[model samples]
Target chain A: MNKLDNQVIIDRLQAVLGDKVHVLGEPHGLLAIQTESAYILELLAFVKNDELLRLNYLTDITAVHYPLQEKQYAVVYHLHNLFQNIRVRVKVFIGGEQPTIPSATSVWQGANWMERETYDFFGIHFEGHPDLRRILNMDDLDVFPMRKEYPLEDPNRIDKKDFYFGR
Target chain B: MSNRITKITPNNPVFYDNDPQDELITLNLGPTHPATHGVFQNVLQIDGERIVSGVSTIGYIHRAFEKIAEHRPFYQITPLTDRLNYCSSPINNMGWHMTVEKLLDIEIPKRVQYMRVIVMELARIADHIICNGILGVDTGAFSGFLYVMQEREFIYEIFEEICGARLTTNIGRIGGFERDFNAIAFDKIREFLKRYPPVLSEFEELFVRNRIFIERTSGVAAVTPEQALDYSWSGPILRATGVDYDVRVTAPYCSYEEFEFDVPVGTNGDVYDRFMVRNEEMRQSMRIIQQALEKIEKEPKGVFHADVPEFYLPPKEQVYNNMEALIYHFKIVMGEWETPKSEVYHAVEGANGELGFYLIHDGGRTPYRLHFRRPSFINYQMFAPMSRGMLISDAIINMSSLNVIAGELDA
Candidate 1:
């Protein structure tokens, strides 16, 4: 099994995407690439369809909310090339007000539910998803609960009070 | 008589047209249904017994683990991981620990790695026992389930001897195990190894060639290799599609590279293939455990944990008598230990699939963000599409074969 070199893959991505792609330093040997929101779909398609870099397996589609950043939400995709046993992480930052990116369901069908999950949690809309509905939450619920601004614990619960714990 | 005849003659002009849509009946399988085996709901549009289409609903068991993990410190999250795949909690625990270790760049000792491998493989066997046995039960063969469940009890006894908890065993720590495997624990492990193989074989004999079992599962819910990959299936499910992409082999973690084992694969990717793959995998797991036991014997005893005083807790006696040990223990327990500011994604071949943890820390007491790449959650995505055009009974069998534990699915 010839393992695909991470550096070569990164160089190839940079060469192709030019300044639109920024190499976020490899952490734990996984090549992390930050791409402009506009080129995310193109980059995903290229990586999946590329002969040498057949990153056909979409491991996960998720988003992270960074409340203080200028582009406050990042839609992250983890892609794996099963043949070469290499994985790469692709991230696209979108503004908090209207976080949206093109859906990767077109590339990998597995992205269908994952995109819906991302939407349900962080309110990051995958623009072309066929069914963009709240997946894991109730339909009538009005909040995207995973955003950083929301408190993790229930504020109304009185059983474990701050007065007793001395917060 | 004349009036009745006249009325019948007038009503004879009526005609009717049959609408195909009227025959479709919508059935809700469960948020709580016996066949579902977990808290999952699938609304099926059926034409009598044949399913026309289906929609699945999950999150009935969702506890918002990632949200809660954002508030807890590093060491405190192991219990939460235990709840993800409760049937194979040790794997989840180890996976979480490895993620934190990767971020912190902690190189654990060889003995610690071997110990983890042993516990994780046992958990894997226990998980496969449940999946395969439940698969038999779903196929209406209850005896095989009973036979294998007894074996699972033996495995749990081993876990209890090691960690004092069976189901949600918070078995190991970030650097290594909390305590060394005592003599009794090693004896229990050896005993389990001696006791389990014949029972597993008997369980297999009950199902592998049984006509009824094979007929029910052989061709049901078949997925091609391409489809399996497109859905990002991993672990036994992906191997059942003939991919041969085991994380233990491809990206060796926990010193898996040092051991010798074969990756079992199947061609059809159906319920039967999944059953066979997992069954063979149990044998392979036993082989790995046997080798690990042998390897552990050569290493020195009583050196269970790595020498990471900052991360590992000090012994009780040391903490009680030694002033320096007491302060270190306080700092460690209070979430004040120093750690790196970095991001990492670590994956282990979990019972279901690729269980991964993506962590981002900003030199804080708690992680900035943590995402569990739950295999059950991802693998369950294909259920609806796969369930289309199958009998409701076969669909039940399909769900069992996927082994999507609700706790992991909704995590």
Candidate 2:
């Protein structure tokens, strides 16, 4: 296989995705790119099946909750092309209320549990996923715990109140 | 439906009509079956002894390490990492520190790098001993497990000499070790190296060619190369499927590229293959540690950590008389040092597989978001699918071979 770099990946993505793809810069030499949530599946498929840029290995799938931004969540995918020893970070921002994105289970079977874990913590619904449920958290949990709104401390802790602390 | 004798054949008669012949029994394999190494519940649909289907139930021990890491300061997060994949906590500890160092851009000394490789390799050997030893016990060979645990305790002694804990080490600081290796630590390592090989050889002699052990594990739960890769497997299990994708050799963190070691690959991804792969990997880890011991002697003696004063805290003795040391120590302890608003992903060849830390730091004392790409959690995803038509006994061996740590799975 030929050696593939950041520029080659960017150019290939631009040629296929046109205006849908955006380069988020290579932070720490890993090519990070962004695209709309709608085109994520197609873009992932293109890169995985592309002859030269076969980033077939999905290193990680996680989402970050950013409450201050216009788009409150950024679902990140770390994809690695094992042959060339290069990695790419794919990010797509989605709106806060009822956040949903297309699932990549059709592209990679490994996406099943990662998507479930992502849904378990951040509550980003993955459309077309085979199994989507709370993975690490109990099913009785009402709120997504990783969101900024939920405090880490328990609500029933009465002794640590401001009055008790002499505020 | 009465118990009347009816002739079905010339010499056989059927009497009772209460046979549940065509039913598939749903059995709970465990949240705590004595055979299960961890607290994972597999609800299996079995036809007699063979499993028709299975669904894994995890999160029995989930501590939300990621959620906790978001609030804790950088110096306080090492213990949180120690809980993940607890079989190799040093690897997890070093992996997290390397992630922070990648984000902060700290240059480590050669001595520190060699020291890390030695500790991490010893951790790998210890991890394999637990995994392979447990596999031996599951396969009805209990004597080998007892022999290996004795060596594993010596490794724990080495860790205890450096940092005062055995299991959840929390061994190193962010840039490097909290303190330099002592004379006793070096002696323990050298002694462990000399003492471990014979027991390892005995372990191999007991199981490698044994007929019963071979029959139980040779063809059980064999996955093809495509399936292993598609499932995002790493470490020995992936290597057992003939994929030489080791994060140590491929990505080469902690100066792993400098080591002369072999990435052992197996022909078929079966239980036996995984067992042999781990055994060979332990030997290779020993070789790497041996080389690291020799290499450390040539490097500078006193340099245990990097020269980065921002992250590495000053010595307590110097903090008393020297005002500069006092302020630096105070700043580091309180997490007051400046940091860049950078996001980076760093992976280490954990005892099991690629233990990655995806950190997004927003110039805060605590991480904005920290995600641990736990290898056991990902590698065990295909367990249910792979156990479809195997016997219940084979399933136990298969799970042991996978070495799915409960802590990492639920984290």
lDDT of 1 by residue, B349-388 (tens): 9998999898989999999999999999989999998888
Winner by TM-score = 2
Backbone clash count, each prediction separately: 0, 0
Error of 1 at B94 (Å): 0.7
Second chain TM-score per prediction? 0.95, 0.96
Q: Least accurate stretch of 10 residues (summed lDDT) in model 2 chain B? A: B1-10
Deviation from native of the Cα of residue A77 in model 2, angstroms: 0.6
Q: Candidate 1: DockQ?
A: 0.77
Best by lDDT: 2
Looking at model 2, residue A113 earns an lDDT score of: 97
CA lDDT scores, all candidates in order: 0.90, 0.92
Model 1 spans with C-alpha error above 4 angstroms:
A1-3, A162-167, B1-22
* Model 1: residue A165 alpha-carbon error in angstroms: 12
> What does the lDDT read for residue B317 in candidate 1?
99
